[model samples]
Target: MAQVASLFTLFTHHAKTFRDLVYSLRNSLLKTGVFTNEKVAEQQVVSVINFDIHLRRDADGHRYIERITECVPVEQEAGYPETFRHKTTTEEKMTAFMETMLEYFRRSTDRPLYVARNVIEYRDGSYVAVHPLSERSRKEIAACLAGPDQAAFEAFLAVHWGDSDEN
Candidate 1:
């Protein structure tokens, strides 16, 4: 029981640490961009860590995980914060919107593609593992980054085919 409790604590801490690490890296990237002045909040691609532990007859247990999903905006529903507001008098609403589009591009395609799961291999050379991305999802991610607007790209797809289809 104590071991299980300790493991849970470790897992939660892993989530917080991962979130902070990604946030720091993202802030650094946005600052260096040409449109740095454009927005306050940037999208963070997140991975949901779902871990399963199974105990064997020998009392040796292991964990398994799902594949890495592509990036989605950090605050998809909340949108940008007030801090992203334009400072210059010359900046118009449209400019802000365009700046947003640009910011989205910079974030959605930048470095640190995968958020590694917290699992670590034990001394016995056995690992409670995490997933690697599949080839199909990787290609879709690339295609999304290649376009100007992600929403527009999705809209184009929706118009032609349908949203229910994953591919």
Candidate 2:
């Protein structure tokens, strides 16, 4: 349950980051006259790159992100009435948008929390901590678990649970 909560928290954070990036790009394009108006820019942003994140737990009690869908808007012909037209060519705008989104994805994925279940599941020695541990503490725990022998495991117990022989 706690792992699910953490995943939710990270998802929310990343969602906000994605939204902000889209809006910022819209504003920039609007200033540059690439878009005729703010409304059209916003529509393009919504249609171009939208993210949907879901949290799921496997049967083995491992919690993870079930899916992340990146939806792109459909293209329509330019001759339609009452349709939003771009000040510039659609291809150019789309190219810029794709580039920006790619950069954002690169940066976001650099963080451990932003990783998906598929990659994490197959990772050697990967395990989710149910307790609320700081990022540093989690790394330390992983290091301890990765050590060569029983002394390392005992050290982990002593550091994390205070389970020394005296106790």
Output the number of the TM-score-best candidate.
Answer: 2
lDDT for residue 96 in candidate 2, whole number 0-100: 63
Q: For residues 56-147, write the lDDT of model 1, one tens digit per residue.
A: 23335554322222232233343543333654544565676677777677655663344334333233545432233233443454465646
Give the clashing residue pairs of candidate 1, or none.
40-84
**Winner by lDDT:** 2
Q: Which stretches of candidate 2 lie over 4 Å from their true place?
A: 1-16, 50-167
lDDT (tens digit, per residue) of candidate 2 on 1-167: 22233322122433333445556757867988879876567666554343445455567998776444333332333222222233277887676667666656754454221211111122233542222323333444466554565467556545654532321
The local lDDT score (0 to 100) that residue 8 gets in candidate 1 is 28
Each candidate's TM vs. the true structure? 0.23, 0.24
lDDT score of model 1?
0.41
- Model 2, clash count? 0
